[model samples]
Target: MVAPLSAWPWENLGNFKYLLCGPLAVKVFHSWNYEGTIEDHWCLHVLLICALRGLIHQLWSSYGNMLFLTRNRRIIQQGIDFKQIDGEWNWDNFIILQALLASMACLIFPSLNSLPLWNTKGFITLLLLHVAVSEPSYYWFHRFLHESNLFNHYHSLHHSSPVPHPFTAVHATFLEHLVLCIVIGIPMAGSITMGYGSTSMIYGYFAIFDFLRCLGHSNVEVVPHELFNKLPFLRYLLYTPTYHSLHHTQMGTNFCLFMPLFDAMGGTLNSNSWQMHKKISSDSGKNGRVPDFVFLAHVVDITSAMHVPFVFRSFSSVPFSTRIFILPLWPFTFLFMLVMWAWSKAFLLTFYNLRGYLHQTWVIPRFGFQYFLPFAMEGINKRIEDAILRADRIGVKVISLAALNKNEALNGGGTLFVEKHPNLKVRVVHGNTLTAAVILNEIPKDVEEVFLTGATSKLGRAIALHLCRRRVRVLMLTLSTERFQKIQREAPMDCQNYLVQVTKYQAAQNCKTWIVGKWITPRQQNWAPSGTHFHQFVVPPILAFRRDCTYGDLAAMRLPDDVEGLGSCEYTMERGVVHACHAGGVVHQLEGWTHHEVGAIDVDRIDLVWEAAMKHGLRPVSSG
Candidate 1:
C-alpha cells in the first residue's frame, strides 16, 4: 500500500519550508491522498471553513438582536405604541437547509472530491473564470436588491444604523445572506466545473475574498481619500469606508460589495457622499471648518474675477461725446460718491442713536427728518439737556453725540457747543480761546463755570483766558505731558492757583461732593479727588461774565486756602496713594461730570462711552 514519494509533495523534507510558505502552500495543503488515504484533505479544509463561518455568524447575529431589543425597549418606554420588526427570521430552519445541501455535496459525491484537476492547467483556467464571472454577477444582483420596493422589504434592515458597527454586517436575515451567497456562488461553481477545476484554487480565492469583505465591513477609518481616488483603475477591486457609509445613508446607491465602477456607471453614486465623508473626517479632527476671513476673501476674489466684463462693457456702451465727458469727470464723480457714502454712514449712525435713545428701538424710518437734518432745529439743545438730566437720575453719566463730519452745524468743535447743560443752564463752547471768547460772550449771566477739555492746546488756552475774564472758575484737566508743560509756561502765574487736575475714577468716588470740569489732556493719568466730604459739580460748557479783563489781570481771583489737617496745601501735589486708588482718568471723570451734573446723561451716551472704551481696548462691562 506504499505509494511513490512523488505522489506526496511534502515527502521531500528539504523543500518543507518552501512548500509551507510559498505560493504553492494552498495547493500542497489541499492535495488529496488516494492510496491508503486518511480521508481527503479538501473535506477537512471545507469543514474547518464552514465551522469558522458559522461561529462568526452566530456571534454577530446574537449581538445585533440584543441591540434591536434595547432600541425597542426605549421606544416602548417613551410611549410609542407602534414598532416594526422587519428582518426577524427562523435561523434554525435556514441552518437545517444549509446542512442538508452541504451533506449532499460532500457525502454523496466522493468522486468529485478525488479529482487530479487541482494540479493541472485546468486549475488556472477555473480560477480566472470563477473570479471574472463572480465579481460582476454579484454586483448586478446586489444593485437589483437596492430598488425601492426591494430595499424596503430586504436591504433596509441592514441599513437601519447609519453608522454601521461590526455586528451589523452579518445582522441581516439568514434568507438574505443565503440568497446573496447562492447568487454569487452558483456562477463561480459552474465556471469551476466547466473549466475542469480543482477545489484548492476555489477555496483559496474564497478565503481571500471573505477576509477582504470582513475588512470592508469593519468600522475602521484607515484608508485615505487621496490614495482611494488615485486608483481609478483598481478602485473597483476593493470596497472603501466611503462606499459603505454612503450605502447606510442613501440606501439605493453604491450597491456593490467590491466594485464601485458598476455603481458609478449606473448613475447611482450618491453626490452628497463625499460631503458626509468630509464631515466625518472633520469631526474626527482630521479636517476643520473654513475661517470666516478666508471665506470672505474667496468671495471677494470671485467677485473681482467677474468684474472685468463689466468694466469692458462700460467702455463699449458710451457715445464719443459722452465718453469724453465721463473720462474727464469720472475722478470727481468717484470722489463725490465717496463723500456721499461717508455722509450716508454718518446719517445712519445718527438715526440709530436717536431711535435707540428716544424710542428704545432702532426704528430708523420714524426719524427720517432728524437723520436728514441732524442739527436743523434751534431748541434741540434744551431738549437734549432735559433728556440728560432724566438719565442722570438712573445713574447714567455719559452722553454720546452721533454727529457726522458732514453736518455743518455739528462739525468740528461746534458739535460740542450745541450740547446744552440744564444743571448749569449753559451751552458748551468748543475750539481755541478766540472761539471760546465768542461763545462766552453769548452765554447768559446765570452760567457759573466753563469746563474746558483739550485746554492744553492753543485753542483751549485761549478759551481759558475768556473764562477767566468772565470771572468763571475754569477747571482744565489734561492728559498731554507736553501740553501740561506748555500750559504751565503760558498760563499767568496767579491763574495757576485755580486749576485742579483730578482723574475720572476719583471724580466718581467723590461724586457726592465736587463737580468735575473738562479734561485738558488725554485720559491715561489719574487726577480726580475721592472721599465723601465734597459735592462735585461738572463745568458747564459756557461761562458768562459781566465784564472783560486783560490776560494778565485777575478776574475775581481768590487766594488758595491753607488747611492745617489736609495732607498737601500745594494745588499741584502728586500723591501716589490718590493716583493708585482712582481708576477712571481725569478726562472720563470730567466728561462724566458734564453729563452727570448737567443732567445730559442718556442711555445712548453711556453706550457710546462703553463702545469707545472697548474700541480703545479698555475692559469695560458690555451694556448690550
Candidate 2:
C-alpha cells in the first residue's frame, strides 16, 4: 500500500522536532510535487532572498558600529573604517562575487540529493553545532595557512587588518572562500541529507553562520568573564569578539572561530587575551586623559622567514655557506621552532607600555627588518599602516614613525598616513624636528664654525639653519655642490649669509664640531678630528669615543633640568638612549600643535622642542 503525501511527512521525517520547521517543510514539500517543476517557480525567489540577506547584513553591521560608537566607543574593536579594504584590489567586487558564488552554491547543494523534509530540531540546536564544529575546522585550516608557504602569497591579505570588522569576515581569496565552504559546508549538508534537517534548519544554518562570522569579526565584546570561569564547559563552545580581534592584532593566537577548545589544546591561546578583553569591555571611553602613542619597529625583512621566531630569524641571519652546517638538524630545528611558537603564542605579550608621569608610550613588534636592506620590500607599508590603525583604535594620541620606518612609509615622513586618513584622531610625526633639536643642542657653544654633512637632507637643512641663526658660520657638505648650493641659495637671508656649501666630508676637519646629519655609522673611534665634538644621529653608535666629545644619538640629548614631574634622564650606561623621534613624539603631544607636523625642525620652534624633551626626561649631553 502506498502512503499519501501528507503521511510521508510524519513517517519519513522522524526523530528531530521543531515548530519552526513547519513552514520550510510545507514550502519544499509542495514545490517538489504540487508545483510540477520546482526550478521554474523558486529560482528567482531564492535569489531574491539571498540578495536581501546580504543587504541586511551590510546595513546591520554599519548600524551596529554607529550605535555602539555613539553610546560607547570602548565596546567597539576596530571602529567603522575598513583600512584593510583600501588596497590595490577592489574589495566590493570580490565581496559581491563571493556572495553570488555562495548563493549559487546554495542552489546547487540542495539539488544534488533530494533531502527528507524533517523538522529534526529547533533554531538553538542549529546554532550549537555550527559553533562547535566551525572553530575546530577553522583552527586547523588557519594554522596550516600561517605555517605553510601560503602565508605571504595569500593569507596575508586577510591578516592585513590588525582589527577585524564584519566586512572583513568575507575578505578572503576566492580559493580560500571555496575551501571555507567545504570546511563549513560538508557537516551541514550531511545532516540535511540524512533526514535530520528541515527547510528551517537550512535557513537557520545560514543565519547563524553569518551572524557568528560578523560577531567574530566585529569590534564588540559581549562574552563576559563569568561565562568562562563559572561555567568552564562553555569556554569550549563560545568565542568572544575579543578572541578574534587579538588574532588580527598579534598573529598566531586565538585561531578558533567560536570555540577555544582546539586553541587551548593546540597551545595557541593568548595569555593576555582575557585581560585585554576586560580592558576594552570595561572602558567608559569618557575620561579625558592623554592616551599613549604606540610605536612598531621595522622588521629585518618581509620576504624571509625572519619574522617567525628568534631561531628562524637567527637561522636566516647567516651566510648561505655557513647556513649549510645547521641544515643537518632540520627535524630538530623544526621541532624547536614549533615549541617556541606555541609557548610564545600561548604566553607572550607582543606589546608593552612605557609609562611616565605625564603620558604613556606603547611599542609593538617589529614588522619589517632590523636594519636597512637594499632590496625592495613589498607589502611593508600595509603592515605599518595596520600597526598605526591598531594604535588609532586604542586611542593613541600621537604615533611616532621611528628609524627606517620614516623612510619606508608612504612617501616617507608619514605623509601617506595623514593623507589617507584626514580625519584620523591619532597624529603622525616623523620626529625629525625633535631629532634636529637634540642634534642642534649637542653643538658646542664655543665653536665659531661647524661642518654639516647631508646638507640637502631635511635634518641637515634644519641643523644648518639653526647654526646660522646662532651666528655660527655653517660649512654645508654634500655630494653635489652645484645642485645643492642653488637649492640652498633659496633659503631666507639670515640662513644664506652664514652658510657655505661644499661637496666633501673632508672640509669639516678644521671645524671644532662635526654633526653627521646623515645616517652614517662610525667605523673607527679616531675617525673624526681630535678635538671635534662629533654627534651621530644614526643608531647603534659606530663609535662611542667619549660621551660629550663623540655623542651617538639625538634622541637621548640630556637636559639640565627636568620638565613636568618627570626625572631628568641623561645619556647613560644604565638608562639607555631613547630614539629622537620617540622623544619628539612626547614633545609633539605636550606642545599640542595647531596643524599636522610631518617633520618639523624649524629654528623658530626650537624653544618648545627643548621643553618637550625635558618633559620626557631626556638630559643634555653629559661628559661621563
Candidate 3:
C-alpha cells in the first residue's frame, strides 16, 4: 500500500544506490528502507538520530579522549586513526568513571542542591569537609605508591614527564586514577545526595564544580597569593599556579587537588609554593635565596668583622684638628659636642696623670663629640675672627676690653676707663670685688661693644652680666675652669645675646701650649709626673685661642736643647731647693741642679751625664 517500494521517493533512491553498488552497499540500502510512511519517518528520524550520535561520539573519542591519551605516544597516535583501535585502562578512565558516578548523583537527586543544609551554611564548613576527606586519602595512597617496592611498577609512569603539564594530569595507572576518583567522588556524591534540594541550586553546584575542575588543569598564572590566602573562606577553594606547579615538580607533596589547607595541616604541603611567590615578589630572576632583613644583618656582621682591626689601628693616628673639624660642619650642633669632648678629655688626662702611674698603657679614651672638640673650637674662633676683621675693614667700631690690676697701672689712681680710637676703642676695667655690683658700676654706659680678657674670676661673670644688660656685645677670654663653668651656666639666661668664651691648654708632649704661655722644657727632661718617660705619652691640647697666637705662639714653639743663656730661668738646684739662673751663667756652672734640672740641661755634653746616671742606676728626682 505504500506505493511500490521502488516507485516511492525513498524507495526509488534506495533501489538506484543498490543497483550501482556492491553487495555490502546493497545490504545497507535494503536495511535502510524496510517500512511504510509512519515506519519510513521513524526510520528517517532514527537515521538522523544516529548521525547526530556519530558526531558526538567523534568529538568525545577524538578530542575528549586525547586527555587520557597523554600517557604514551603510541597510544595517542593510535587514537588519531578512525579505524585503528587500542584499549588501555588508564587512571584517566577511572576518573571518568568516578565523574560519571558523581554526575549521576546530581541528576538523580537534583533537589539536594537546594537543601538548606547544603545551600545555607557558611562556605568554610564545606571547604573544610572537602579537604578533610580528599587530601589525606590521596596523600596516603600516593605515598604508598611511591614506596621503593611499588614505585617502579605503579608510580614511574606518572612522574615520567617530571614536570606534569595539563595533559599529564590524566596520565596515570588505571588503579591509581580509580582510587583517586573514588576517594574524591564518594564524598562529593554523598554530600549532594543527602542534601538534596532545588534544581537551580543543583545546576549551580555542578557548574561551579566543572568550572573549578577545568581551572585546576589550566596552566595560566593569573591568581595572586594575597588574594587567595587572605580570604578566610576562599583560601581553601582556589589553587594558585604556585600551588599546582609545586605539585608537578615536587611529587607526593602538595597532594590536595582542590584545597591547600589540607596539605598545610597534614605537613605535606610544599613550602616551595609560598617561597616561589616570595621570590617572584622580590624580583629574583633565578632560584636564588631570597634576600631578607636577616640576610642584610649577616652582610653587616661580615663587613664589621673585616674592618674592625684596621679601624682600631688607625684610630690613634687621626689628628684632633681633623677629628673636630670634619666631624661637625653641622650648625649649632657642634657647640654642644665641643664642650662635651673638651670636658671629657680634660677629665681623663687629669685623672690619668694624678694617679701617678703611666707607661702609655693605652690610647686616649674617645667619647662622642670629644674627637671633634679641638678642631671645632679652632673653626669657630676663625669664623668669629673673620667676622671681626670684615667689620673692622668696613669701618665699624671695634671695641676691646682688658681687665687689669689697680696697682700695676701706669697711672697713679685706678679707674675703669675706655681707650678711644678713630674706628675702635680699648677699655681697662678695675673691679673692687668680684661681685655683680662692682661690675654694674664699672662698665661704661657709652660702650656699645666690649671685650673681656683674663676673665677667669668671679669678677668676669659679673662684668659679663653688666655688659649684657647694657646691650653691648661681649667676648670673654679666660683660663679658669670654674669661671668657664659659671659663665656657661648663666650666659643662656642672662641678657647677653652675643657672648663668646675662649680658653686654652698647654700641650704636654710635642704639643702646643696656648692660653697663658708656653712651658718650654729642655729636651733632656726624661720622665713625666706619671713616671712615664716623656717620649712615651702624647698629650693633646684642650683649649681655645685666637688665630694669631694659636699657630705662632703655641703651635710653633719648638723645644730647645738647653735653658742656659736663653733668658732668666728658675730651677731647683737639687730636689730640695730652688735656684735661679740668668743669661750670664755658664752651662758648666749648673752642676748642683736636681735631676729634674739636670734633665733640663741644654749642653751637648749632657748625654755623657745621662749615660753615667744610667750606669749608676740613679732615679731622676722631682720630674716636672
Candidate 4:
C-alpha cells in the first residue's frame, strides 16, 4: 500500500536539496547589509540552528561507527548495508523544511522575531511543556503508527534498518517526519505564544531533541550501568541506546520518544531492556572477537582519505571519485591527513564477514607519496612490522600488506617481518602469487609473443617465468642485463630461450600483447601496434592514452557470492571486488595454509593459487 505522504517534493533533488534555502540566505544577507531589525534577521538564527543540527548528527555517526572505540559495546554487530545507506542519505532534509516553516512563522507572528537572547522562565516552561505535552503525544502517536496499516505504509521505512545508525534517527516517511515536527515544535511554540520565549530556549530545546534522538539510535551503548544503579529512577527518565534498540528489534515494546517513563506508564516497556543495557555496557576486551584476516592498507591520496565507511556512507559504498560536494571538506581533510602522517599509527578502517569469519581493514598512517621518500622507508617498515606483531599477539590468522605496504625496496614484500619475528603465529602475506595468476590468466591462450615492462621486478619475473613454461615468447624490457639474466636463468632450460631481453620500447613495435609491470609514458605506449591491449600490475594505473587499445584494471577478483556484511568498496574497485593481493590473503585464510605467503612469489604455485581461488568461488575480474 502506497502512503499519500510517502514521497517528498524535493526527494528527487539529491544534493541539490540544499538549494531550497537559497531564498532565505539571500533575504538574510540583504537584511544584514541594510542593518535591519533582529526580526528581519530571524531567518539567520533558523539557518544556523539547522547547520548545527546537521553537524551534531554527522559527529554522532562518525563516532558511532568508529569500531575501534565502540565495537565491543555496539548493540548491532552487523555492518550497515547499502540499501539503508541510500535510504538515509538525505536524513537532514527535514532540517531545511523545519527552517522554512520557522521562517514563515516569524513573518506571521511579530513577537517571535523580537525574543530576548535568554530567559530563565521560558527555559523552565519549555521543559515542563515537553514533559506534560510532547512526551505523551509522541508515545501515543508512535503506538498509532505501529498499527498494521500505518506501519506497512509509512513507519516500516524507518524500521527497515536492522541496525540503527545515528542518521537512522531521522529516516522516516514525509508524514512521519511532519508529525515529528509538530511533536517537537509544541513546547517551543507554547513558550513563544505564552510571551516567555527567548532565542536560547528555542536553540537549546532543538539541540537537546536532536542530541537525544541521535543518542537513542547510535547503536553503541555509552550509558554507564553504574549511574542507573546509583540513581535507581534515572532509567525511567532517560532512555539508553539499548532501550531504543529493543524497539527496533522487538517492535511491540518501548515506544517512548526519549524517556522510558511514558513506556512504563503505557505498559509497553520491554522486560529485557535493563538486562540488555547492563550486558552491553559491561562488555570489555576479552569478549571481543579477533579478526581472521587483516588487510593493512594506507591512504592513496587526499581524495581517497574520505572514502572510509564512516565519512560518507553513500559515497564509500561505490567506487570513489572526487565530487563537487566533497570539495568543501578538502581543507579539514587535508589537516587530518597531516596529523595522521605525523602522529598516528595503524588504525581500523572498516570490516565485514566472509563465510562466518571476521575480516577487517586497517590503515597505515602514512600516505602513498611517503613510501618513495628515502627517509620515510624506515618509518613505514616499522609501522608494518608493529602491525604484524600486534596481529600475532591477538591470534589473527593472516595479515596482508596492501599496495605500497609490501614495496620491495621498503620491506622486501613483507619478508623482513617474517624473518625478524620467526616465532610469530600470524601468517604475513604480500599476496602476489594470486596477483601473478590473475594477470597471466588475462592473456589469450593463442598469443605467442608479448612485450613485458618492469621485466625484472617481482611480479614481472613471475609472469615471465610462468608464460615461458607455456612456450610463449616474452620480450623482457630492462636496461640491466644482469637482472634480466637472473630472472631468465630461473626459467627451465628449454623455456629459457622463450625469455628474450630488450632495452628499448621500439623492440616491441611488432608485438600486439603488452604486459606492463611499470609505468609507461605515452611515447612508450605508442610503440605498440594499433590494437595492443595493455595488461598492467602497475600502481596508480597507467593512463589510457590510446582509445584504439583497451587497458586492463589492476588485477582484482570478485568476492564469493556467499560473502556477507560487505558494505564498503576497496579503493577504486567496484563493490564486492578487491585487489588480487587482498583476495590472495583471503584464500590463504580460507584454505588454512600454515606458510606465510611473503617475499618472492613461487612461480610453481601460480596455477595452484588460481585453482584454490576458483574452488572457493573467487572469480577473476574481467580485464575489459
- TM values, all candidates: 0.33, 0.44, 0.28, 0.97
In model 4, where is the ten-residue run with the lowest total lDDT? 32-41
Off by over 4 Å in 1: 1-43, 54-100, 115-132, 272-624
Whole-model Cα lDDT of every candidate shown, in order: 0.37, 0.56, 0.34, 0.90
Greater TM-score among 2 and 3 belongs to 2
Model 1's TM-score against the true structure? 0.33
Off by over 4 Å in 2: 1-290, 299-378, 408-410, 519-527, 544-554, 557-577, 615-618, 621-624
Compute the lDDT for candidate 3: 0.34
Point out where model 4 deviates above 4 Å: 33-39, 285-287, 338-344
The clash numbers for all candidates, in the given order, read 32, 16, 12, 0
User: Of the pair 1 and 3, which is ahead by TM-score?
Assistant: 1
Write candidate 3's Cα lDDT for 1-624 as tens digits.
Answer: 321211212223432432221332333455565532232122222233234433333232233222212211111111111011111112123223443444454356545323453354333333444567765677677767778756776666666643222334555565565575566554445454455333334334434443444344333333554564576567555665456666656676876666776677778877667666444434322222111100000001111211111121121122112243333434433453345335332110000010111100101112223223555443323332333333334332221111111222221112211221122221111212211221233334565544443444333454555456566665555566576666656655656455656442111222221111122233312111222111110112212222222221111111122211111001112211111111101111112222111111122223443333233323232221
Clashes of 1: 32
lDDT per residue, candidate 1, 349-407, as tens digits?
10001111210100011121343354543333333334334334333333332122112
- How high a TM-score does candidate 4 get? 0.97
Candidate achieving the largest lDDT: 4
- Give the alpha carbon lDDT tens digit for every residue of 375-405 in model 2: 3333345555766776677677777776666
In order of TM-score, best first, we have 4, 2, 1, 3
lDDT of 1 at 180: 54
